[model samples]
Target: MGQARSQAEPVRDDSLLEGTIWTPLGSASFPAEQPLRQGHPPRTEALPERTATRTSRRCLAAALEAEKQWARAALGAIGDAVLTIDLRGTVTYMNRVAETLTGWSQREAIGAPLSRVFPLVDGKTHRTVITPGRRAIEENRTAGFALDCVLVRQDGSKLAIEDSAAPIHDREGRVTGAVIVFHDATRSQVTLERMAYLAQHDPLTGLPNRALLTERLSRALGLAQRHRHLVALLYLDLDAFKPINDAFGHAVGDSLLQAVASRVQECMRVIDTVCRQGGDEFVILLAEIRRPEDATRVAAKLLAVLGRPYCIHGHQLLVTLSIGISLYPDDADDADALMHNADTAMYHAKRNGRNGHHCFTAEMNTRPLQRRRTEPGLHHTLQPSQLVLDF
Candidate 1:
């Protein structure tokens, strides 16, 4: 009777059997065969056709869901702000950084206009910076903004931002949307500006230094030549400056120098460039000089202004200036030569007497050759025989 029942009708299989599992879509078997436990379901081939199809579909749906979650995690992990816009410039997606940068949540930003979401402007001009997303999509390429771009956040605060946009292409090579990447640039921009300022200015007096003076002189020479004009350089030195520093403490002497710089600056036109050429000296470049005598007039005014008494640290002090003038194209063709000639004339003024001005002449260049003969270093190189003969 038991043999007849088993052969006559199909029954639930209680015994384990390993075989290929056939589903509606395709077949997938288990990794390995184990005993068919009594409470557990039978092998895959034992399942109904409809049930097999349902199980396969669920697995596919779960895989797609996991892939989407992974993509969202990747976008959130990026450091820079990121957003995506359609070809029509509508905001379609935003990462966590983008939401933070715009001060808008992802839900609030999606489906918004790109301009409304970004709200960028030129920091210097205060004019609206055109959104690069539309341009990138239209041109089917990438576009970027200058470092001066500023983004206005949702709360009305402004941030210095730099960004770029690239068009998204479909498999068919058609532009579909654009991706934008941006980050804060305020710190780097300020640091670069500060470094550039310190490079060209003096630490003590906040005036242009000699290196900057040379740069401006070259530019001024170009303009003067183009306009058929001449550039004049007035090199100035404080007469007996060392003795004053010796008489008083350096702190008081520094205050006196700072005061002198102010008065000297007050004696020039806005077109003039006054630069501090190290201790107790300054070089002034007068751009677009109509007459050589114009430099002489400016030098006289500066001497009068700088020679006034200065009260520093409650102590009265008196100082005088010696100025030497040289004209571009007349004194020398280049900036360095003009500076050297002016320096020579300043010493010539000192030799004649303190507190005066002198115009450079061709004979001033010969002073260096004369000085080399009497230079103190040359005395060190003299042989004992030469000294004995002199004795």
Candidate 2:
């Protein structure tokens, strides 16, 4: 009975502690109760801070790597050759285009001097420039001049190059190196020169056209005005050229005009310029003429040349020219006035006789002034005597 009472008392005490473990307000006890079956309810594991930090670092490194790859791809995609060199003239960077322009690969060109890799020459002299890189670096200026040079290829073939050089500068306003961009301008330059020549010259007769002739006449007049000298302007019209064109065809007419143009050029002095003013008309600018007789001599010489028959395309063409002379300052002041007076004088020569010469006079100006004021489209053949023909 004593042993049973002792066991019952211990059981009663355990029940009291269990009942107190959960209070009326559900407050927790001092020490957590461990389950008998499970070992301490498996203590919850917390994540380490170092592991999270390591994960974030890995993500940032991946982002940086992706950006670097994008930049490299962008640099490789450009068409123009890009080269970066140090101030000491050593090549530090070169793109794919650079490798293609110069036969040296980027691997071989890197760290090589620019002069040794791509040498340039003077255009006019064809001499190699010794220190182009040094000039760009020291001067801190850009330079661009025609350079006729040859590029040595990897396969030993030579490529002719016309290149322009420019200096590259840093953020500190100092020239770091130079970059040269060039292409084949051989065919293009020749085409341009031919076009320029054609613009200033007559395509048929190969003489100065109206535009160049006028420009030279203006300059000659200015010089004459300064030196108190006279300039002779002669206007010539082929009299029987139309008949030749009608009978023998346009090809014969063109041949006759070309022959006449050559003959007219031969009659004039070296200082004089003979210009074709389109369609059977020619103008001669006689520079530094002393007297009016000098112009008469030129007109006589032109008439003699044109009096001969031209044999073209198995046809003999005969043509005569009527010439009119006008003196600068004595006839008119400016280019327009001089040209108009000469034209009026030319018509007078044509009306007086088919083959003759007429000079501008003061009475010639009055008739044109009267015609301009009264009659707008009055077409009258002015005779040498009716309009002032004496200079």
Candidate 3:
């Protein structure tokens, strides 16, 4: 009966394993005793496929690494500073410029708080600046930093900086992090200020130039007309300046002009403006003076002060100015007329002597005020009436 029952049971084939194996063509399986055929590729044939897969994987990894290195190089080589932070406000990455500007290394700054990496303050208000990156991350938008912003570095040094922050996003358009780009704008700001200063001031003597003088004169005239106050304009020319310039080099001449400008500035009040018209000519605007005699006093004081000898570059030089005074309502009303009359009076002062002041009068204009230049010196000779022209 046991033999009969064993004969009734079907024998299971262990060699015919029900398992899948990778092949060169695809996945397949067969009995262990069966030879590999066109329908079923052998295990040995799968080696080429596996090797090719490995090679593809290695190539992909190498390309990704190269891309990462290229990105780092580009970031490091940029002129502006770059910093990145996660949504939690933790620093994630920093470029070379960012490291130098913030005084924090990437190794030291990574995983640190954003505030620790980038500390800022207002340049004018001296208050703590709010981080725009945090706002950008939270609001999911780009934000600009404050104007005239100053950055206080990790080592306690400070620099002027301008920066902006933008929210970074993933492929799905979800906000992932924030990027902050900044740069050192101190040099640029200083350059702009220097340019503006040069526009209105004489580069040689550091005095107000003709453009600035005219602007101030116009404003002063307006205020004087409104308040019924007197405004005085004193036109001055350095006597024999050309002869001295020709005798000495331009270096000595420049030094002499600077010295004269300094002396003239010292003789004026805080409310006055001393201007350099051009060359050795200067104009003084005495705004809101009490009386005409007030200008006379200033002129006398300037003559006394500037007439003194100046020691420059081991040479003692003496210079004097021929000043002409013009009043707002007394000489002429407008700025141009007042300036012209003052200039005419300055010529008269030159005609009288080298070191004196004259007040403008209508009679001074009646004569041929235009003078012809004589050779050998800056001596002037009165010309015909036709020679008179607008200054």
| Best candidate according to TM-score | 3
Better of 2 and 3 by lDDT: 3
* Clashes in predicted model 3: 0
Query: How accurate locally is residue 141 in candidate 3, as Cα lDDT from 0 to 100?
Result: 89
Better of 2 and 3 by TM-score: 3
lDDT of each: 0.80, 0.71, 0.84
Clashes of 2: 0
Give the alpha carbon lDDT tens digit for every residue of 1-391 in model 3: 4565467446344233224343454334545586455653334664576566666866998999999899889999998899999988899999999999999999999999998889889999889998899889888889999998888999898899986999999889999999999999886778899999999999999999999999999999999999999999999998777666766668988998999999889888898999998888899999888899998898898898988877777666677779999999888999999999999888888888769999998998789855633233343442222222323
Ranking by TM-score: 3, 2, 1
**Residue ranges of candidate 2 with Cα displaced over 4 Å:** 1-119, 123-160, 163-189, 367-391
Q: Which ranges of candidate 1 are over 4 A from the true structure?
A: 1-154, 163-187, 367-391
Give TM per candidate: 0.54, 0.55, 0.69
Question: On residues 153-202, what C-alpha lDDT tens digit does candidate 1 reach at each position?
Answer: 99999998886999999879999999999987876678798899899998
Residue by residue across 54-101, what tens digits does model 2's lDDT show?
A: 557668889989986886577668755556567778887777866776
Q: Among these predicted structures, which one has the highest lDDT?
A: 3
- Score candidate 2 by lDDT: 0.71
